[model samples]
Target: MFTWNFQYISKARLSSTLKQLNLSAEQGDILIRIHTAIHLADEAVDLARFVKELVPKAVIFGTSCMAVINKGNYALNRCIISVSTFSEATVCSEVIPIMDEYTGTVLPVDMLCGQIKKEFVRDNTKLILTFFSGQYKDAGHFVDRCNDFFPSVPMTGGIASCAQNNQDDFSDDGFVFNEKGWSDRAILVAALSGDKLENLSSFATGARVIGDESEITDTFRNCILSINGKNAS
Candidate 1:
């Protein structure tokens, strides 16, 4: 197995970063890490469009960050990307629709397990990575639901970061869509194994506080009316 890595450190206007990266898209696969330093949707769209234009054949997976870190420590208002080629790993990942009826329940678990079996075309999975949006969903609950389905598989990944109407550290909850037309609010699930994957690993970090810390005494479909025995509004 050969370990080849590519790092793109070029300076260009955010509007032209895509063009610059396209200049470097010469081989294998590309892993993208983007920081909008503003809105998650806006910055994500820029990178997604660039990926489609430059590395159309590469499998892209990444999250927006309040602080993006690479070989160094952490950074802000910067887009850091690391490209590596894996000749021995079989990587197949997908995003599923956000189920409205499967919150803090067992139904999502059952559905995910069945889907994984069908998607990867195998029931023997070793590692699974999942992420959910903090805006309209519960990340912890989703993780629990997934565990219920694949109790034996090693799973990791956390909720995506969210700032104000505009925050520098941000990433889309799921796959980038504005450019490639991905589901807007959905959960991303990836299953990898030594046989299918020559190698597999992942990590993430965030500083933006997502959602409210107050308790939800009562609510309905993205609207909460009360908290801690009192009216919220």
Candidate 2:
């Protein structure tokens, strides 16, 4: 069985925030969800620095958000960190980008499923948690690919946002290996299967979908030119 806990930190005391967590690397896995107004590079650097000093051994994974999830409320300019430890189940995780050398001009959606199929070819993958750059190309394509490949692998996580401008935000999430020293903004997949893991639980919430569902009428590359036969923007 696994137990989960959640916490959050703002940009004001990122360093102090990490210290306050009092995480131990020797302990079980810890996932960190960060919300920042800083640039992508800065956010990554701050995260890397904290992860190195605190809980160095835990498997830390999470995405940046405009509004983070903590105690059940959405807040801004803050970072939310969720930690989970496994006592009975063994978890295997992998991260991959939406585009790669082997994919070769394939639709972004197809690329996602292909990566999953390749990495978890043997493990009984149960869930995929991902954070995407709001400006990413082929966002819909990637979602479609996820549905096609592992229809059963429920996906969660938020699209990175730029709070100041309310424009496209770039966010990165990843699965880390303390021993291996690896990290990225790629899709993170977690495969859990062991005699001890008797039950698996997941949660997801998103923006409201108003009015009748409309069809995407026209699109070019990553932008939606039209929806429901009307111009999107």
Top candidate by TM-score: 2
Q: Please write out the lDDT profile of model 1 over residues 45-133, one tens digit for every residue.
A: 65667665665665555544455554676555555554444444444566666655557333354565577656753454666656554
> What's the distance in Å from true for residue 209, model 2?
14
lDDT of each: 0.52, 0.53
Off by over 4 Å in 2: 1-30, 35-40, 92-95, 100-108, 121-123, 165-195, 198-233
> For model 1, what is the alpha-carbon lDDT of residue 122?
47
**Which candidate's lDDT is highest?**
2
State how far residue 53 of model 1 sits from its true place (Å). 2.4
Clashing pairs in 2: 25-57, 109-141
58-130 in candidate 2: lDDT tens per residue?
5554444455555777665555555555554445555455445565443356666777667663344545556
TM-score on alpha carbons, each prediction: 0.58, 0.60
What TM-score should be assigned to candidate 1? Answer: 0.58
